[model samples]
Target: MRLSGKRASQLALNAFIVLLLAMSIYPMTILLFGFTKDSLTWQYNQWLPALPMWFTNLNYAWKQVGTAFWNTLFVAAAATLGGVFLSSLGGFVFSRMKFYAKEIIFYFIIALMMVPAILGLIPWYLLIKELGLLNSLWALVFTSVFGAPIFGIFLLRGFFSSIPEELFEAAKIDGCGNFKLYYKIAVPVSLSSLATLAIMQVMGVWNDLVGPSIVLTSPDKFVITLALRNFSMSMSGGGMLTNYPALFAAYVISSIPLVLLFFFASKYYIEGLTSSGMKL
Candidate 1:
């Protein structure tokens, strides 16, 4: 059948997109398949386990990676919660409250984002050590610190600004104080933006490796990425790949929290991010 040029172009674009998507996910797909196998069969070009091997691999991977998984989750959750709350408050102030030097303060805060993160890492590590936080999850938490997260204040400020001033005035007239308004009114209404920020912070903290690797010296305190690297290195040591399927299984297991988090929060996340862009 003869096809129009535009239709052909659309078909070509769709095929390219699907191809790219497959390429992007192919490695993870292999890792996920390894979760179903009790052995490192990907080396032999085998993708799926023959049958009933999932339980054994999962158990092995859990025994190896469980502590790291929980540690990562704790750090991610702590950083996200604290950063979101503080950034929301900062956003509220920058957006709704008329305060002196607000613009200057905000611009300075945003300026920190321009300084390459790599440049700050040395000082950050030194600071962590000075505080005697080396080899602790507290170091990891403190590194992610409770401040306006990169772009978080901007997101929330813009969102808060978009909320009608009349709402604030109405709350004031109803005998609501500023704190009450923030707690009862602003927070409830800003859940979408907050959720978006929370998801980003969680992903960033969960995947973080270099910072934790530098700050955390103990094997047990390692976050997921550090733990994965350690596990892989140990397995590959002495040219003998030992139980590497269990490592792949760990990758699969480690990814589950973020996957489930996004699965649930995706609706609000998409709305918050896209709405901000549209408004801008």
Candidate 2:
């Protein structure tokens, strides 16, 4: 039987997609199995972990935890909310309002993105020290929360720019004040951009290791990555305190929220990226 050209193309594309997916998921699969598999006993030839595995590593992680989880949750959530709100509001203003030197100011800020993030570390540390925010979650939140990165603002600006100008005029005519226009009209319709912004900010703030490591000295003040680094490697296994499986288990556990968040927000995330009027 001769296969149609379209069917053959579809089959090839499906195979390509599946292969790409497997490539992407390979690292995560190893970490997932680390939760159940023993690090001590391993066969190199075996791609998958051995059977008869137990949940000992996961149980240990759950019961032997400290403040890393809660601290990460709070910081990530606060930064995400504040960063998203501020960026969206800024986007609305830049897209809808006419002002002097608007493009000049916007381009100036956008140019800051070209500057390497490493260049700001010194200044950020100095600023944090001056404000007495050292050893505090506020240092991390402050970096992301109220003042957002240029890319985030840039992304939301494109989305807001795509919205019809007539909507804003109608809202104003109906007695909608500036804040109300933004909060009630702009925000409600921009859920896609908002979700993308929130997800990005949350992931960035949560997974941040360098900032927290530099600003924070106290063990209890450590976020998830730093805390996991210090604690997970110390778990008992493999005839020593350091257990590879336990560390991977901790990584797996810590990543749950982010995975779920992306799963739920992926629709809106894709929508935001694909929306029209994404020009500068």
Candidate 3:
């Protein structure tokens, strides 16, 4: 069908957006293809490199990837659980309860958020060392848990505020105590925000490299990101070929969990943001 001038302009604009999207995604696509390929040489010759066509690369990468994957999983899970629980509790208190020095305490938490992470690294390291958590997954988990309070508290407070006070009053009238009201009413209503914050915390803890790099000195304790760095370092040689295919394979494997989590949580994630802003 022929298009009018305005229709043609809109089509052209959409085509441009599609082109940009493809360009942005091409590198990742190529890297994924490289992961399946038998040899890195194929990358130089074709846009669509010949993959292993068999599954050997994936199997090989998985052998070492499992340990790192688990390490990351443990840290991320612990951190997200701790962060969501503590932040949600704190948010509820700040939003619902009026008490002495509340504003002062809240401002202190906000100020803590403003401090650069690097500035606290040294003291954190010392504390972890003194506690004998250095070089252990607990170090990573604890560090993330402590670091998460700022944004977690902030996001959850907004969510708690968005909840109607009438709900709490109604619950109280129905003989619900403070704990029961928080657990049964507020928490159920704030599920979306909690899920969103959980997603963010999981992603952050899973992908963090710097903190783990300093604390986890043991190779056995390496997370996926650290393992990827180690793989890259080992592949780089003076005037020699890198094992691009293997490294790419590792990269692809490492991203699967994160990609799957986001896809599964996308609906709740959107709902969370919208609900956090909804008044009453």
Clashing pairs in 3: 36-52, 37-51
**lDDT of candidate model 1 versus the reference:** 0.81
Best by TM-score: 3
Task: Flag regions of model 1 displaced more than 4 Å.
Answer: 1-12, 40-45, 147-150, 237-242, 278-280
**Candidate 2's TM-score:** 0.86
> What residue runs in model 3 are displaced by over 4 Å at the alpha carbon?
1-3, 40-46, 49-52, 238-240, 271-280
- Per-candidate Cα RMSD to the true structure, in Å, reads 2.6, 3.2, 3.1
Q: Candidate 1: lDDT of 20?
A: 100
Q: lDDT (0-100) at residue 84 of candidate 2?
A: 83
Predicted candidate 1 versus true structure: per-residue lDDT over 1-280, tens digit per residue: 3568889999999999999999998888777666676544445645644554555777877877789888988988888888898888888888878888988999987777677788889998999889988888988776675544657888888889989888899889999987788888899999999999888888889878889878888778888988888877877754544675677778888989978998899999899878879442
TM-score of each: 0.89, 0.86, 0.90
- Give each model's whole-structure lDDT: 0.81, 0.80, 0.82
Off by over 4 Å in 2: 1-13, 38-53, 63-66, 146-149, 232-242, 276-280
Instruction: Give lDDT tens digits, candidate 2, residues 192-224.
Output: 778878877887877788999899999778888
Question: Model 2: clashing residue pairs?
Answer: none
